[model samples]
Target: MTLDNQHWERISAYLSGDLSQDERNAFESWLQDSDSNRLLFQEARLVWESSRIKLRVKNPATEEELLKLRARIKSQQPAGRIIPLFRNSALLKIAASLTLVTVAAYFYWTLRDTETVIASGDQVLTLYLPDSSRVWLNTNSTLSYTEDFTKENRTVTLKGEAYFQVKRDTAHTFEVVTPATTAVVLGTSFNVNDADSATIVTVAEGKVRFAERDAAREKDVVLTPREQATFHHRKKTMDRSRSRDMKFAAWRRYKNVQYEKEVKNSGLYLATQYTWRKNQINQSVIEGTIRNSASLAVYRDIVLYVTYSQPGGPQKTSRLVIGETVNPGQTIDYRRRLLDIFTETNVLHVKVESAEVETGDHY
Candidate 1:
């Protein structure tokens, strides 16, 4: 196989680990084009290793001494005996010059094809993709994609964390490729975080396909709006759950709010009543009442946590949410039957999560 100066330069930079993210991806694509390409890279790398030593000025001598050494070596060769090209010191100097040129050209060429944005402080950088997608790079994060992103596909390689507002393109899929996972979507908004050993993907709008990569178990998880999935590297598993924190990506606006705990005795009022069912001693009924005390209407979430001590074993706890909305001064009554014979009647805890302020008119 034959390679021009540009290809040789790229191989050299790749061997040196100097290629940018986009350039590395492009070089990998080139390497996969054919078997001959791989062989060429291997051969070029070997040649590079051997030639680097020759390129160095191990022993510096004055111009007169160098000329004397060159002429003396030429005279020692047998008459009519052909000397190889590299044995000639002048040819070696030319080859070293070409090597230096290749290194310089590689840096210049890679800079032209890739664009990088880095957020090094307590601020975010807004970037526009070739397809018009918007990205907010978090502090100490980086986002690198092709300068001509929309030509074939829209792909961005991220390090650290970033929130993306991708433009919709049904023809081309928008992809965020990280070290641990790859998220693919047509057009959506999401936040991706590389958490050392795992990758967390939170979907804010639309749907996304979160696929695990560079892990033991390959899995594909679909995340809907207000959903999150964490890909764990050690376990090689993907865990999906409802995302309670909506302001996870709000750091870009500096408006993130971590909820505060309300006083345990305020806001929600709980009452419980028990009854025996059909004169059966083992079965009983427990009636519960929850009242909203706030004057303004709010959405209330209630969790009934029950703890029971298993015989000769450890204690266990289970919780069930009372999914309902209550208006101001409204009361909702619920009935809970104690069907479990082993559950202690008095070992229960009622927890009321803070009520969210209702939006829209209450009328």
Candidate 2:
């Protein structure tokens, strides 16, 4: 009932297009009275402006954006082009009904004392939890847990994909909950992929038990090193297979082997850069060659081939990028020195006398 912490929530709701006309009037009045109200709206704009939250949308976006879209409608009202946006019967019904659900959930989650949602966006995110366990989230994936995660059973939710090199704790089993099933491991490294209805749990070291729970059906499967268990939800069955766990999950190590992929309109190799800034990238430059169809397979090994102009040793790379795709995001590591053909020291480069790779797989 009071306008304290809830003030920010109201502003957020308004920015998200969840507030009704009457509620919008109330918010405007509140904003007029308090300077902080305007400031708070500015902060919420950051979240509303982000592109990450768009992926969760069930329908295509017809409006420009939350605040910006609504602003456009107001500015273009005289032209009627923007008035139709607010008058759109379909969008009004959808926004009014759906706003309560999403905004409420977002507000509650943000107010919670614990729990966090970590995502890499277009880059790979590295996390060192309180328990000393290391988690590498692939591009376009999410890893979330309560702030007191390790205190409990080490439970976490996985969306998209990630590779884990968990610290061994037999007393506290690490549980990964995907959309389909749960994968439990003692202390080991593994790769988990969520492909719609099925969850793929691949174990590289130690052992893991995957539990599939449903009202009418329940099953459990134990996987050893170099093994995988795929849990299908709709059919309520699990399929198990063997894989080279270490080799398969090597992407977690920030390894990459760039090769020849046919050039298209954008034929140049793109050099990757990163920044800690919230609104924009601090730096970006063209650093490497873009491969074309002439090149075949890239690196299958987990090793790294990096170069640097400075006199620094090979102890650490300024940037860290992965060679494989665990999900949809594409990330380039910082200070990534590639042993590329462009780089004179690359051993993989094929010279005129060098044997040609008849088959791409041979590389």
Candidate 3:
């Protein structure tokens, strides 16, 4: 595709890692939309890097060839005879100008598309797009975009959950793509969570155009602030309602504003200590006791994800249910054996996953 100057600037920003989360995600979505965009991005990157490669160390064979060229030049000319080519400085300047123009045109044509992918594994990540828009990706989430982002339309593909604070761009509309739904807006802040059970879209600020992802006969609705919509995958239905609780986007807000508070009061922090012992069969056994620190009883299953890492070696992470229906102030024990041949586990990152508050009575 023939891209304009705007596309070039976007690609430049992407290469410099200056794209915001929304822009980055949008650009990657454009990239996935076509293989040609991807190939163009790759070629542009190679060309951009090739310019720097010129400054690197030269091959010995190249130096030898240069010496041979110099020797041939010296032998071809008569003694004390000035070269005709060097005598015409005007011709030399014209040749230099033509060469510069050729290289610039080549780059302008080749480097028009770019792609970016961001993944938040255990912790949340905040990023800015080329247009200075901001987006925050939740844990275990991914976002992607392409160079054409914001140039024509601001679009993004998201997996899992994300909180977006898009910059105002009246000329172009911002859109978020998920497997279940597509959210369209113009400079608005919203929260999108696409989980196995359902895809939830909550408008924290401004309005959002939420639509189903069906190719044929798509359905859409406008969601106002404090309103949330749920697209149930199993039911193949979309439900919209005014949120009963004001914390419709509490999960995203918690990660952004009260992460430290959540960490301090969470169940993982309530585990006062841990014990590790080697069994008779040479397997390492890890043990820890977690307590329900929150006031609400945890009726749903709470899993503790632990990452085992050794110095200068690959890391392995595994999840196990620490407890189910842990009442307030109740404690539960966790024990697991390491089957890998790792001599010692040096680094351990423990966090709670899949935690839910029990609404009904849990005796």
The candidate maximizing lDDT is 3
- lDDT per residue, candidate 2, 84-182, as tens digits? 112234334434445433553453344344557787777666677677887777778888776556765687778888878788887898877775567
What TM-score should be assigned to candidate 3?
0.41
The Cα RMSD in angstroms, rounded to one decimal, for candidate 2 relative to the true structure is 20.1
lDDT of each model, Cα atoms only?
A: 0.60, 0.50, 0.62
Of 1 and 3, which scores higher on TM-score? 1
**Candidate 1 per-residue lDDT over residues 1-363, each given as its tens digit:** 334444554566666666567666766776666555655564454233322111222232344433443343334333332112122243233334445344433434444445444553556666677788877777777676654468767877787888887889999999887765789999998899987889999998889999875322245788999899998878878899999886777565432111111223333444333332322565345566777654233455556655544346565655656667765457887766545565444444444444444443332
lDDT per residue (tens digit) for residues 1-363 in model 3? 433333444555555566567656766775665555664454444344322111221332354533442343234333332112123243333334333223333343433335567788877776787787778788899887766676766877788998888888888888888866789888887889999989999887799988776323246889988789998888888899986665544454334433444434465434535666667775667787667664223435666676777788888888766545665557777677766454565666666655555545221
Which clashing pairs does model 1 show? Answer: none
TM-score of 2: 0.41
Candidate order by lDDT, decreasing, is 3, 1, 2
Q: What TM-score do all the candidates reach, one by one?
A: 0.42, 0.41, 0.41
Supply every candidate's count of residue pairs whose N, Cα or C atoms clash at under 3 angstroms: 0, 17, 14
For candidate 2, give the lDDT.
0.50
